[model samples]
Target: MSADRRRILRTTAQLAALTAAGPLLAACGQEAATAGGTAAAAGSGPPHPHASPGTPTVLTPNRIPSATPSSTPGGSASGSPPALPPLAASTPPEVVTGPRDRPQIALTFHGQGDPKLATALLEAAEQHGAQVTVLVVGSWLDQQPQMARRILDGGHELGNHTLSHLDISSMSGDQAYAEIAGCADRLRTLTGSIGRWFRPSAAQYATAEVKAQARRAGYEHCLSYDLDPRDYADPGAEVVQRRILGGIKPGSIVALHMGHQGTVDALPAVLEALQQRGLRAVTASQLCS
Candidate 1:
């Protein structure tokens, strides 16, 4: 063949080769992306003190097919936690617990106190492949705005615990409404929507009127626990663990608190005990579902 013809033939062959490899290269790129996404989703830190404090990736229910969509409002994505959707219908505005038929429990935290201790407890649960719920005081969220996102990012749930962590049950209706609504507004601004669950401050159970106010504020249910280890008293970790383990049963909701070193110390053992008993520690949403 003439030199010009040969050069043209070589160029044509190169073009064909490039065209054929394009799909394979594209496929490779896609695979890599998928793998990374999965790791980011699953590897959202050990929920320990060492977890990435800067916020981790958010995975929608679609990313986790086994996960039912948030029974309440708000979801998350990308950098900041994204509220999933507006509340279609109010969640049942009644007291609830995980069903007794299941061998699962919810380890719920009162969201306040030391950020580091809270982080430690969360990390311990995550290390054991458990997910817990944190009902945060609005004021606490204000001091640690990143914590709202951090809680959700750790494959956990974050909800309202009143704005000032005051005695909502004792307040007048209008006063109670402000406390609920105010905290809710903080959650909305930080994480896209007011979280699903609300727990009254200074009281384990909500009064009839407080429930009404919470419903008005948009929470479907006010959370209550079946067990209290009294970790809030800063009781030693052993006592906290004993109290919880003693009362733990299928579908039990254990009221725990953040910012206590004892609770943090007790959590890992409690998780282990649950695991050995063939019980799983999960978020309240997961437990209820």
Candidate 2:
């Protein structure tokens, strides 16, 4: 594996271990509490679908493998998607993939852009028997509050991307706190919870400050992805499809975008490929659960 891949896998494992040991209680929530008042213990979260023994629910995810799948019977991740339970408080840093032995992957989206496009992608995922996660921008959620319930109704997961979708990693501590909590407030107002996950905006990974803010905002883990097709660049559908299909592996967490037509166009083929490869597309919590 490449250094980047190795680093991702290692970090994910360490974070997961720390969470299981229950050391995640001391982040920013002690420093700056969000208006959403996520006073629940840090690391509390929605239960995972196939989590290991003692793995915390909604704790950030696992490392992915690069190998292809075998033609094993019932490896089809064709799941009877479970209705998402109320998410507990957020957990710590990140989970990039699940156990390597499972033929599962998490398909996560940045929730912004056109709602129609977002709905289309949801339909595609549903039709293909997939469950996904959407880390939404607070402002966008303000624009389309209905999407919160829509996503849940479809058996998907919703998390915070940020309040303003700004360059969150570079912001001052107070600024970052507001960004994380602002979104928490919005999600709480619309969905009755601050969400169980956080992802930094405009960066591939969360900085220490951003993670601290997320922690303070009652998020235990920051969601991260291993596969990015860069669909935001307006690459054609074929390119989007090829990039993801070529790179995806077991327990992979994919970063994709909404509002791009090419990404919308690429969903069908991606779903078909995963099914053919004996892999199932699932939400991050489900993949790590």
Candidate 3:
């Protein structure tokens, strides 16, 4: 194989290691993507050939190769779709390819009201020189305006996680609209600009009703996770790190809880491991490009 192809293969191997270790605890969350099925972009790097592993770039994902139906029994009597060409060098960054060859992962935090934990997460990000995004509850902002302000002042991105966090899908039309729009309003007032993104509670978006609600509320897109650290459930630090490192792909929006202690414990390793892999940690919006 050419050197570029070899690098792609090595990268694919790393992504496989992540998956074998399990994903970031997204039990049933819909895959988060731009309208065009793309991952966000953060920075620039080389164009490697289509290899598998490490983490797939969300900005430009290579669909896992599918099996061909045979001419024999139990196969589609019809012919198969043509084999997908291998990923090309110089694919567009906005296309949501998996895992960056450059060191970078966007660290996402959920919940509000706990300034200590919030500060700790931010401090960790700063200590490691990683970019961070904090998704704050509207009420959380009310209780912790200083924390919210600190996040923005610290150069982190602050996003909306909805007011009251009622499951948008289960809510009535007006209620869903209120939940999303209310939060956006609060965030805009708190941070000046409107929130650039919206991530649903539990990473769930059950219907078009909720999707429309978010969009109408002025969100660019609903945020979902490709890797879930399961920090919310209080997984051990080691477990969280293992799951994230094993499962994360490039352009993956990793979900962790700002409300939980395990995530706080795990943050350092997560940052360290990312650095060791030459991945730079950034905010969700920056990754979205």
Candidate 4:
């Protein structure tokens, strides 16, 4: 063969060999790229879409199927809230207590002019198993020494109601002090024991000065009431009784005038009402002290 023909035949054979190997090499390259892509997607041996930078996914132990939703960074579903502790046992609320645990109620009489009625009240109280506190006017005590002594001797408490039952609020502070102190002094002298309880006339209007003066004159406190029968105005026995029974409570101080017949009439029912509620009627001193 000639040298040029021999070279041409050699080139043609080389071209055919190249064409046959092209498809095989392309398929091998494609297979290698696909394998690399799969490894990257699985987040193994390379960074991938499934992987977050600098974050470690720690598998929790004993996780339930329900717990999977809470595993997300900002997931709403979560473990149960912490439980609240039980409340401790508490004491029942009290209406209120006095110096003594036993319930006491006061029956205070306003005026002091009638000694015969006062003695009758004291006797009635004794009969009904109740202690009494007599608020005496200064002149009344002076005028009725025998009756005053009887009340003192009978072991009843004495309270000053003012010298003339004057409206202390209408007077100057000095006058108010004198009216209270004068009566208190007479009461102390006659009874031979100082009184600490005072009830203003009509539970009348007064300033702090009256209270201050009473305190300065060795009085402890004023006696007032949660229940008022208004027996003094002679509203009638039934009305007074209803008012008292409806308003009465434990540790309440009841006010009624000894001078009124209505009070005397209402006393028996009032006592009955108190007894029904398991309360014992007592003097103001007993209530306070």
Task: Give the best candidate by TM-score.
Answer: 1
Error of 3 at 22 (Å): 69
lDDT of 2 by residue, 1-289 (tens): 8999999999999999988766455554545566224534431232221112221112111111112222223232222223444433432356655557799998999888788999899888888999899998776665566677677667788899876666776678788888788777766665556767898887878888888888899998888988998898887999999999999999788999887889989999999999999999988777766
Clashes of each: 8, 14, 42, 0
Worst 10 residues of 3 by lDDT: 56-65
Candidate 2 lowest-lDDT run of ten: 56-65
- The TM-score measured for candidate 2 stands at 0.69
Every model's TM-score: 0.70, 0.69, 0.64, 0.62
Report the lDDT tens digits of candidate 3 across residue range 1-289: 7999999999999999889756554432335543224422332221111112222111111221222223332223233221222433543322222346644567777756356877787777787888777777665554454555566555577777766555555666677777776666666555555556677654444366767777788864666666766666666888988999998766667777675667778889888888787777776655644
Model 4: ten consecutive residues of lowest lDDT: 58-67
Off by over 4 Å in 3: 1-103
Give the Å shift of residue 69 in candidate 2.
39
> What do the candidate models score in CA lDDT, each in turn?
0.75, 0.74, 0.60, 0.60
Residue 142, model 4: lDDT of: 48
Count of backbone collisions in candidate 3: 42
- Taking all chains together, the TM-score of candidate 3 against the true structure is 0.64
Each model's Cα RMSD: 13.7, 23.4, 26.6, 38.9
Query: Tens digits of per-residue lDDT for model 1 on 200-248?
Result: 8778789999899999999878889888878878779999999999989
